[model samples]
Target chain A: MEQKETCFAKRVRCIVKLGGAAITSKHKLETIDEENLKEVSSHLRQAFVPDSTSANVLGMDWSRRPGQSEAPSFVDDFSDQPAGDSESFIVVHGAGSFGHFQASMSGVHKGGLSRPLVKAGFVATRISVTSLNLEIVRALAREGIPSIGMSPFSCGWSTCQRNMTKADISMVIKAIDYGFIPVLHGDAVLDTLQECTILSGDVIIRHLAAELKPEFVVFLTDVLGVYDRPPAEPGAVLIQEIAVREDGSWSVVKPKLEDTSKPVEFTVAAHDTTGGMVTKITEAAMIAKLGIDVYITKAATEHSVKALSGILKGGIPDDWLGTAIRYMS
Target chain B: MEQKETCFAKRVRCIVKLGGAAITSKHKLETIDEENLKEVSSHLRQAFVPDSTSANVLGMDWSRRPGQSEAPSFVDDFSDQPAGDSESFIVVHGAGSFGHFQASMSGVHKGGLSRPLVKAGFVATRISVTSLNLEIVRALAREGIPSIGMSPFSCGWSTCQRNMTKADISMVIKAIDYGFIPVLHGDAVLDTLQECTILSGDVIIRHLAAELKPEFVVFLTDVLGVYDRPPAEPGAVLIQEIAVREDGSWSVVKPKLEDTSKPVEFTVAAHDTTGGMVTKITEAAMIAKLGIDVYITKAATEHSVKALSGILKGGIPDDWLGTAIRYMS
Candidate 1:
């Protein structure tokens, strides 16, 4: 019991979600966006990993740099003088083109293994997602980050009625305790009520956040941040900050809304079996309610590095374009 | 409860162990014996999977060929016609050269997380073993086998005092229930007593046999079978049959040895963290004690096809050279 407490005391610093669209060519069949993935991996390495070659690796020394503004009290808990220290974190990634097509076509998310197509899709989805996970882990490994690929289904994560009910994360916890980064992705898992269903990465991170209770969370997406509408649409505006109330309702705090009556509209990808942007926001809000700040930013961007490195803790900087979800204090 | 009974009724037909030495060039680091693996996979497909292209693929249509002799009453249960029907089974493979070097170098088998080397080695071993598992899955997939890789460690498998204590095989069961072959491998798992230790594939199969109660088990090794000594040693002879007693003692059946005083001498690989040939025999004996026939034979040989296809059931045929360990009736 004493050993367990000691291990728990070294809480995970952060949980990062690598959005499927950001790392893979979502429209293509099972194709990875190699350049973007490499860039994101490098950014992750610079933010969380401490390298002697790079002096001031982000998160190593949490103190403000020259001419940097003060951080908020919520993040003050991490502003200690620990030089050349690596941050402990877990990564949950989306399946993107790797599995979405098969899962969608076979209706695996609907969950009935009695059909041969669903059963075959279950196998194909796992193979595809796990293969992507291996690629991501390899990229992280090349960047000197010790990453292990962990498939949710293989690890006994399951859902009941399309909602996660069980997940044996002891191995995941042990991996973090041993200084290894466990890389998980969206997967096809067995469901009690449905027989099988797609367990999305968004839901996975939300569950992990509730279990591990990291200091903060970051979602690296393809877009700049959450937009009132699809980013490609004309006059679509990014929502900078979302504050969640005790009642679980949320309001946009940034770009002050003159008309508060209109609820923000978000678009989800047509092929995504799991609710897309809406699910991300919902999950992020849940994490925020736990008193942990959540940041959603474009992958491989300077803003993503800043958000991941604890540089956007106090407030979203004028130059930093992303969405910050926080609890209403 | 009714649904559960229906699923359990479709019990796994057989459990096959692909020896590391048979499928991998063990002397070389992380090298797979591609030719041998392909041949073994092809044989497995032919024997277990019913392909329209190949008639009389082994295991289907259990009726003997023109000149073939009768099978034993024990195997009579499977002698009925099963034309163009696939057999349900599971595959458990060893780490081979893939993870042995990393695990041995860091003493991961001894198990201590305090040392950085051990931690790194644990990650390296997982990476190495999982990569090889992917290769095997891909090979099987190409042959139209719905094989899913399930790492023991990832699935909440753990040991206490070097013995398996917990293994949530719900997913394995679900996969089998859904007609997908769950491919498991020797893995590094957390040990309650040692912090971590290597879980041998042999041990895994034995545990599965106890749980799933397969009709038979096959061990595909590089050598013909369990030899009086190592196969390469001078004047080493193959042991055709051994009958295990209720008390767990066994004696050579076919040889009719005058001297029953000497014990079998088996050697282990220097780099294998899991006990090698000795562990195989011990686990095989335990499985045999459960009243299931256990066959040990060289992979990719006609003898292996015979053993796997249920052709060498009543007794060992002169042409089929291998070891059959059976519970004495």
Candidate 2:
């Protein structure tokens, strides 16, 4: 079938996850960080080039007719750089203000769909998350990224324990093969045991990283990266590199948990139903176990964008910019 | 699992369809008939009461306590009307100017997803349809209908011949059981052989009618009803009733192919990728064979709204208003 052929044709090469705090105002309900979103979207657009070799071949043939200097292909002047031969990307975004407030109110993140009391919260969460997805898609479009928004809840089924047993990723694959970025966000999904639960974007990114086998998985967050001490502490030090051990444990620089002198102010927003920094690190560790390089960087920072560009080009970015987690066999 | 219990808990009791031309300006690209849509939405909200017996029981006990004249059971009065016990509904809408133009341009209705040239059209069609769904949901909310939009593409799968083999109606049933109207629309769906294809709302309505045994299935369209001749023709007579035979064939009056004297100007809109009036009648007949009453009525007309109210109350409307199709055996 054409569907299978298309899926095999384009092997996904990259995954960029935009954190909720990075693109939306986490503390303020329903407020989007429009400036940061646009800036990050523009950087993302420049990072990946949609492959157009099939059309280019025809253009080359037409230009070679009789005796004439080669006519530049239509995209020659339009594109800022040459098209990436095998670059394809998928973007996963977290649900900040759109879903968090309602979800927390209903305890949906803790699998509260069985209670009739959570009904209003469920409806509001779905509508708000979708509303934000529309905005995210529009921002990406403004930057010339042919981005299409996808709903995780609508496409995936979870077990009673919130284990996703099945997910229809065919559409996502088809979109990528057609040179469109499939944009996904955190959503309220139906679960067999729980009735319904919040499926975070972090978990989705891990699933996608395994399915797509992308060379690099990037997580654009609010802070710089993982740190030896609490990020808010006066003398906290950034941990630039994290390595996965043979036993699947992470080996990153960290301060002892028993150190009472350390000030840990890793704030989880009031309405955030899902866990904050802890969840991100755990998901990143899982992805790192797959032998994929996972970069955690701050959005709207020049150094972060530069590091992202470097990763897109398949090179080592500046070490001091962000933390990179990888497997060491 | 809770999901299985919820699925079997609620049996769908009604279905109301809003036609593309009724809510959208079919001739204009992406232009919505806001006034008609709002009017129709208000009527739809009044027509069905979500089953709230389970929640009402809890609320009644709480309101009986001393010093409390009444407990605002949250949704009490917040809802447009008293929740209709054992009354639940699912709404299917057509993809008007939003999707039809792109679907036709790419010939998706004829299975065009196999070709790479139509890829852009495929993505565009999906986005446009969802955009329209957002508007529809917002309109429903304005009328206090707890409506949630579901994309068929994200929730269903079709075969090579465009037959929907798998559609997750469990979520729909669950939504109704929890007091929400699941709004579905025509969308670009994944296909086994074709890669992707357009699933018309007419086909979806028939599928839902068979799955969910609703008492009355209403089709809100731009015309009054089906007629012996084209409604625009001089001296044309509206057919009040149609009966389906034992063999599942229609007993209504139909025109012969050789009748050249007829004007035959049943205009299918320029961008309409699906079949026109003929298809609607065919689909309605199919639903009739399932032993359900199918009413075709004008959306904006006061008479049609009154007829809808009558049907909702399980009674006969005044005089001849809209055409009702049913089965005898």
lDDT (tens digit, per residue) of candidate 1 on B260-303: 67655322232123326666777888999999999999999998
lDDT of 2 by residue, B75-157 (tens): 43333333334257788899766777767755666664434334445655676788788778767754556677788766644
Question: What lDDT would each prediction earn against the true structure?
Answer: 0.76, 0.66
Interface DockQ per candidate? 0.17, 0.13
True contacts kept of 2: 0.09
Candidate number with greatest TM-score: 1
lDDT of 1 by residue, A1-329 (tens): 00111245458989999999899887666678999998888888888876623332122111112354332122222223333335788999998777776677667899877655566567667777887887788777656566778899887788889988877577788777756688999998888898899999999999889888898999998888887766766776778999998888888989786566776532323212332677788889999999899999999999998998887777778778999999997
In candidate 2, the residue pairs with backbone N, CA or C atoms under 3 Å apart (3 or more residues apart, or in different chains) clash, namely A160-A193
Index of the highest-DockQ prediction: 1
Among all windows of 10 consecutive residues in model 2 chain B, the one with the lowest summed lDDT is: B57-66
Residue A278, candidate 1: how far off, in angstroms? 2.3
